[model samples]
Structure formats: C-alpha cells, structure tokens
Target: MKHTARPSLLLGIALLMCACSQQPDRPPKEAASPVVVAPAPQTPVDEVQRLLARAARSDPATANDLRLDAATELADRGDTVRARELLASIEGARLEGPQWVRHQVLLARIDIEDAAPATALARLDNPAMQTESAGITRATQVDLALVRADALQALNRPVESARERSLIQAWMSDEQQRRANARAILATLSQVDMGELGHEIGSATSDDWRGWLELASIWRDLRPGPNAQRAELQNWQQRNALIPSLEPAYRELAPEILERIKQPRRIALLLPLGGAAGAGAHAVLHGYLAEHYRQLQAGESAPPFAVIDTTSTEGGFPAAYNAAVSDGAELVIGPLLKEDLQAFAGNLELQVPTIALNFDNENPLALPKLYQFGLDAGDEVAQLAREADNRNLHRTLLLADASPRARRQVEDFNKQWRARNGVVLDTLYLGDLNDYRVQLERTLLVAQSRERSDMLARTLGFKFESEPRRRQDLDFAVLLADPVAARSVRPLLSFLYAGDLPLWATSESNAAVAGNRSDQDLEALRFIDMPWFSSAEATLRRSIQAAGYSGAIERLVALGVDASRLQSRVGLLTWLNEAGLGGATGELSLDTQGRIHRRGQWYVFADGTASPEKARPETPDPSSTEGGTAWQPQEQAPQTRDAPPRITP
Candidate 1:
C-alpha cells in the first residue's frame, strides 16, 4: 500500500468544483423560441418595494435581505444611478442574524466602488469601516478584503493581486474560514476557463437552495477563473488545446478519480446489427468482444457489453438502454447508425457510459460520456500521420481533395501535427486528379525552382542563390486524395522529387488488382491504417459465410459488425486498452485523445491488397487489387424496426 504521508496532488486529486452561482433557465432572446416580453422589458422596482413592505411587516428577517440583494444586483448591472438610492433606502434597516454585516459592506462597496482608489484605500483605514472585533460574521472580513483588493487592482495599487492573495491565504489558514476558499477560488477562476472549469463541476453536496443560487451567481460571473489566469491555461487556450499542461497532469491521475465516480463504471456499445451494417458489425463484434472477453478470461474486469439490435430498432435505444440498466449493464454500446445515437443523445438521459459506433452528423462533435469510433475516411489519414510521426517525418506536404470531409480531415491533421511536431508545407485542393502525376511533377518543379525560391525568400526578407540543382526543405507528402488521386499524384510527385520525400496515403491507396496487376501507381505512397483483419484468425473467418475469404486475408468490412472495424480501431480501443483482430484495418489500441499509441500491423501498399508484415509486399498496381475493395468488407444488416424515422428533434 502506498503511504499517504501528505496529500499527493500527483495522485488522484479528489477535486469537486463548487459553483454557487447558476444562471436562470432563460434561452437566448434571438432563438426561434425567444422569451420576449411581448409588452416591453422593465425593471420590477415598484414590485420590489411592494414585496419588501409586505415582508417587513410579516418577516422583517427576510425583507431586509431581499431589499439589499436587489440593490446589489442593480449596482452590478451598472444601474448605479438608481441602485445607490435602493441601498440607501435599506441601509438603516436591521437585517437578520448574520446578514446585517453583509449589508453594511455591500452598501460601503457602492461608495468604495464609486470612490477613487486612494479614497477607497483611505476608507478601508477607517476604524468604523472595519467589522467589529468581538464576533464578526466570517463573510464580513472576506467581503471587505476582496473589495479593497478589487479597488486597488483597478487603480494600479502597489500590491493588489498579491495582497488579495495573501489575505485569502491568511483566511484559509484559519480552519473555520477555509470552508469557502475552494468555492471562491473556483468562482473567480471559472470566468477564465469556462470549458475547463465545467469538466469538474458536478452536483454539490449542499441541498440548500441558497448554495445553488450562489453557484448560479458565480457561474454567471463568467469573467475568468484562476485556472484560466495560470500561465499554463492561458498558453493552452491559445494553442495545443488537446494537451493542457494541468489536464495532462490531472488526467494521469484520472483512473483513481474514475474509480471514485461510481456511475460511469458502466459502458455502452452501440453497433448496427442487421441490414447493410450486419456483416461489418458482426466482425467488429467478433474482434472487439473477442478481445474484451479474452481480457476478462485473463481476469481483468471488463465492462459489460449489451448487444442491442441497433439496426432494426429505430426508436427503442432509450427504452432498451433503460432495460439494460435494469438488467445490470452500466454502460451501453451499439447503435451503429448516426440516427440512433442522435435519438439517444436527444431523448435519452445518459444513464451510463456510451461509446457510439457511428459519429454524429456534426463533424468532430463529442457526446457527454459518448465517444464515436467508426471507419470514416479521416481515420485513415490520422493513421498515416501517426506513422509519419513514428518515422520522425516532421515536415509534410499535402495534396488535397474536394470532399468537404476530406478538407476538414487534412485541416485537423495539420493542426494536430503541428501541435505535435510538424508542419504541413501546403495543401492543394484540386478538381480533377486524373492527370495528378503530371500536375504534381510540374507543381513540385515550379515550387522548387530557384527563381521561385528567390521570390519566396524576398517575401520573407531573405535571398537564396538561383541554383536549380539545390534541394527543397520539404520532407513528406500526404495524399488526402483517394486511390484515384494516388494513381496519378504518386508517380508524378516521385518523378519530380523521388529520392527526397516519402509519400503517404490512407489505406484507400491499396490499389492491388487481382490479375492484370501494374506496379506504377504505388511508387511513393507508403502509409499505415488500423488493422481490420489478419491471416491468423482461422475460425473467425469460417464464421463469416458469404464473401468467403481465408483468415489470412485482411478484412475491414467486419468493422461495421460491432460498430465498424473503424470504430473498434479508434473508439473501442480508446475506451479500453484491449487489442483487436484488425488485419486490413490495422489492429491496435488508442487513447481518448485519438492517438494510436500502440503498434498495429502496418500494410505498405506494395503490390496492393493489404500485405501484413509477413505477407509478400508487392509494388502498388493501379488496377491489381483495390486497397479498400480488394478485401471484401463485411456485409451486415441493421439491428431492427423498433425505431422511428429520423428527423431533427
């Protein structure tokens, strides 16, 4: 057992942010369903006085508090003109037990707020301004100190940030006063990093409505949280958002924290089971479930996988998931279609951890405790980037495609790659790639021209000698275009800059034809992909009847079975560290950040059809075997008909 000599922030830091301020449930005014005051919007001032007078006669204890609160809010909203009158109207009244002190300070703050910094500092020095020493309300001191701090900081006083921090430090040193520090600090810091702050804000322990009200208020104070103020948060918010310094440090300790949060202990898998998705889902279910079960057989506790019929049942994910929870599955998996997950995301409460088999229609969207793992074209590009990373290919050139998704994929890859260690030289979006090779050759020759280099140099305030034989600084060329693009660009790029750069492609570049195989197009596009299947799963192949191929051949069609081989490759592996039988898709595990950290079978497009490490690597033949079509994809059907037609809810 590890010795707990002191609270190790390094270990799972059991931190729960307490936000006392909550915003009212008011939708935006410009939304289709805007909450317009049809008549007109006006401050309810007279109403406040009416309520106050009634309360004063009935419950003076609450009356003073209400009046004082209204005044403070008006002041905060910049109605300082009239807010001063409201505060003055209530300043003479006796408030309940501890609220009297808050009133005085809030009243003084209006003056403190209006006065010059020097005047505010002088006011703080007044004996009358200080809370009584005998038995001061705890908040009084804090309120005074914070006001003074804000005032000083506003006017460029000598030690505002430090002095405020020091006073808070002193307050926290006192055991009794320490209770609210976490809340206060969290409130202030949340303003800076709203997204970051939200990751940890769950329900608080207090049932008191006031606590919730305060959290609402604090949350509304969306200025900047302390975390946002930190040098690290500031840096990450600008760049490298995927890897916040504090988050990584915190994430490393997440397992322990996860161990403590009981609900997400369950996971859900949503895969299409029948119809067009059956064959793929079946194989995916085979590899992923097999791997997970294999781990369980090895004594690891695997989360339960509830194989719901996501194919047929168009409308029952919610009810079915509730049934799963009733039956003991903590999380869910399988809804191999986007519509089903969308349905669940819209209507169903996230009862358990859900790992979606298909991505949402919104590109690059995240679901609450919901992650998608599917075989999209982009996954292939990411795999190539990973391989490039391993090879230390720090500089890259991108040949683009017209597909919107492809554009975003390349864009994300460049953004992430640069954040990692590389730069994308250029991405050329083109209309037709039929003459890709010739075009690439000419483009490279021109871009590499001494004259062109000299012009570019002049733009950058520098000069390069007009030497034709000199090399270019670019390292790798990424083919975001499809197999068709590969057929042209590969030979052309190589013909121009053959020895200097390595060309990359998604598994789509697999162009191996069966009989009339040609080795021309595979000249330089060497890349990596998630393994969908390999030659080793003997019995697994026998299980798949039609499109009968040997286990020796790699298969990616099976990915749709469970979710899709693509989903298993990224999402499933990300949720768990288990291995899959991704022969063609490339088998390996992934982390939540979508990093392929483990080694998977790499199939270089030699002669085409994916050739595993042991298989003979042939030169890429444009018509030999299509990288994607050469290996028959799993032909599966959807799960069922319990679901309804898809429409935006």
Candidate 2:
C-alpha cells in the first residue's frame, strides 16, 4: 500500500541525508519517543545534499549560512534528527544576527517535533535570543513567532498560541499569507470554550490580544439577530481602529459583511406560475415568504418585493427581468429554470445583480452580476465520493435503477471516485426488483461459487451441500435509487447475504418520516440529506406542515427559504472564499464557477426513523484500514447450497 511504503521512502532519504553530511561524534539527546516524521518527496533530499556540499568549501560565515539552509530543508522533510544535528553544528560555530535567529527557531522546532514542548518553550523564552531576534528581518520575526505558537499549542495552551500568531500578522509581507495567519488565529481561539474565552478577554494583558479575542467572540455568538450581530461587529471595529494588523482584513471584508445584513431597496421574484412548473414555483414562493416574514418579526427592515410570473408575462424571462429593473429593483431572485437561466446568460443588456434559481452544470456561465443557487442533486454524487474516500472505501460496487438520471449520477460518481484513485469493482443497473438476485449473483460472483460446487460434485462420488459465497473484494456499495426502490433493494440485499454490508445513498432515497412501519426496511442505510429533516429544525418542520406542505415539495420550500436568505449575502460568500453562510437548505457557499453549493447533514435509518449519524472518532483503529476488500466472515458457511438472500453484487 502507498500509505505503508511512504514512510520507508522518507526514512531511506533520511539515511541518505545522514551519509551526505558529517555527523558530530556525539549521541543525539534522547527524545521521549521517536518523532513521527511526515513523509516527503525525494526532491528535497537532493537539495539538502547540495547545500551541505557547498558549505564544506565555504568561509566560516558563509558555511554557517549554508548549514542553516540545509537544516531548514531537512526540517521541512521531517528529518528532525538530522536537522537537529546540522543546527547543533551551526550553534557550535557561535552564529549571530539573522542566522542566529533562524538557528534558535529551528532548534525549538526540532524540540517540539521530538515531543519536548516544555524544552521548546524554555529555549524560545531565552531573553537573550529575543533581544537579538528583534533586529532580524521581518520574515525571520514571523518565523520565530510561528515557532513559539507551535510550542504553546503542543502544550495545550490555545489562548497563548493564538496570541503569538496575532502579534506577528503585521510583519507578514504577503497579503494572502497574512489573511491566512489571521484565520489561523481565529481557528485556534475557536477551540477554547466560550466560558474560558470570556474569562481570557476580561484578563487579557495586551491590547492586540484582547482585540482579537473580542472579534472572535462577536463572530462566535450565534444568538444575536443579523442586525444585532452586524451592529456589534461595527462597534468592535470602531473601538479597535488603532489596531493596524486587524484593519486590512476588516477593510477587505467590510463591504461584503455590510451587504450581508443590508436589505435591498426593491426586490423582484420571477417565477413560472402559469406553466407546468407552477406547483413547484408556488412551493418555493411559500418558503421565500416564510423567511421574509421571519426576518421582519426579528426587527429587520422589510423591503417591498414584486413577483412577476414569467409564464403569464410577455417575452417570458427578458420581459419579467426588464420590468423589475425598470421599476428600480435593486436585486432580482428568480427565473427558476435552466431555459430561463440561459435567457439571462445570453442577454447582453443585463445589469442588475441576479441570483438564478437553477444552475446549468453542463453549460456554466459566469457573468459579472449573475449567481446560481439551487438544490442540485448532481452535487450529492460529488459529496458521496468524498465521503466514500474519507471512509477509505476505495473498492466499491454501484447499484442503481435503470434511468437516465441514475446513469448520469453513476457516471458522475465514477469520475469523482476514480480521481481519488478508487477502483470500481462492479456496476449493476437494476431493471426490475425481481431480477436483483440474478444481477447481484452475477456481479458478486455468487454464481461462480455455485458452479465450483457443481464441478466438485461432478468429480466426487456423491454431492454434498455448501453455502454459495459472495465476492469479498468490494468495500462498500452505493445505492442510487428512490425510497420505494431502495426499500425493496435493501431487503433483497439482506436476503442475498449482505445484510451487514455498509450501504450509502443520497437525498433521493430519503422518504417522508410518517412513522410508517415499512420505513423499518431501510435499517442500516446511511444517507445525506438537508438539515430540514434534522431534529434541530423540528419546529421549522412543524411550521411547514401547519401550512399543509410536506413530502417532496418541503425540500423546495427549504430551497426557497435559502434563496431568500442568500440574495443579500452572495457577495459575502463570493469574496471570502470557503466562508459558508448557514442556510435552511444546508451550509451555503459559492464556487468559483458562480454556482452555489450546499453541504448537508448525514443521517442513518434506525428503528423506523432517521437520526443523525454518530460522529466518527478523531482517530480510527489502524487495523480497520479503509479501501480494498477484506470481509471477515460473520457466520460459518452453511451446509446447504442456500444462503440468506445474498448481497453478492
């Protein structure tokens, strides 16, 4: 396996690196345990050798600089032992200035890597090192702060770790790197409980440290309404105007943040109310109005919005959009169809910011002011691939109903899975539930087991019974079918012998929670669906049901609610990439393609109801490696040719 081979490759390079340089005739100070070196490519080992050879022929100062470079390379490769050896050699030469700062920082880094966080902290706290490092290059200062932060984090001191990163943000030359550092500081602070965070803010010693903690507190407080949250953020920014390092990021993000909470002057909704899509459009309208009213009840200003039925209007999409703009509409949120979106995409006179209700994944277009938001089922296949990869389920079998949409999903999942270097052991398209046994038997090689028994019987004096075995090379199965079809297939899989095998599905297979006993047929099925069905939104679901909306249309209502909320914050998500806005539909984010993606929650069917899947442990058992087929027999092979209805294919 590549995973096991990787460490050996890095260790071989470390051995090669040791041979290239002269080792001081002294033992390495013993570590509590071996440093768990990160695997690296072979390129850096060659570079380290060249630097050391150059150092051998240089003057004392130049040689020490070369040695420092060599040590940095080794450290990056996770060759901590050899890296420390090189640093020790340089320290013996009495290095000074920027070189001395780099040497001390690197020694502390090695100490941390060797699990000696206390020693690392002591070395970095050397008052003499700090005074000398002050006049060093800005880059070196950032490096020293980063080393100290790592030491603090290793010691479980998150508050001090965040403080060290906060202190060096202004010294970073690259704007992008500085932004990343700020994000890291917030991330570290997020680990501290709110109680501890509040206590630290009250007792903070440095102004900059206190300012960062305050900003983090404002962001983490989710109880406040949108307006209240924005007001607090603006107030905090005004109070910390003198904090130079935090100002640039705030300035860059302010426009988007303000836009997020600000309501448009006039809004328009374009829906096909008279066409075949009228029912679906009305469901979406219900959801949109629900959120609009919810926001008003929370003391936010309500902007008047006009609904233009594209089906009843002249010139369809163009007429509806022009009418909205002519009436001074500041934002438009509609044209809920692929053809309508194409009309907007082709119209050269489009100027107002618009959010299309659907995306044309095949023919994506990115105009300056156009954004796409929708509940795209195709996106779920991509998510499924990622989930499968995360579970180490590489060798997979796909089973789906024979439909064009199912075919597209299979193709899509295959593309994503193969990109992750996963192998597709088999794919079976189901035409009828009655034939699943035949299809699965063929795919899982169950028929081969039967034939082997037949052949053995032919050679022997008498026939004996043996259980038919399913192929064990598949790690898991992907079920792409509707609830009705899944219910049938799931039980059939158990009958065929794979009841214990893991099965995965997407929202399509998720059925209404009507407490029907038949729902028990989906036991053990793990699937991803919107948070709308999660218990956290029990009240919201009750409200929707009170309005006489349920089943498939409920998802559209949730989509409509998200569309309403996203209209004002699309700009925010666009500028701050990867920053997701929590929406009723899911965690809403925008991809570079100008299409909004939703990441939903995972649930498992149990006791005739779906519940949130249990969170996976931070560290999984190494013996239970993911990927490849290794099925441990759950029961001994039966003496008869029959096995419980099988899960072979």
Best by lDDT: 2
> What digit string (tens of lDDT, one per residue) describes model 2 on residues 138-158?
666677777777777667677
lDDT of 1: 0.45
TM-score of 1: 0.41
For all predictions, the C-alpha RMSD in Å is 21.2, 10.7
RMSD of candidate 2 to the true fold? 10.7
Clashes of each: 100, 9
lDDT of each: 0.45, 0.70
- Top model by TM-score, which number? 2
| Cα TM-score per model | 0.41, 0.68
Over 4 Å off in model 1, which ranges? 1-308, 324-331, 361-371, 376-383, 386-392, 430-438, 446-471, 497-500, 511-520, 533-601, 608-649
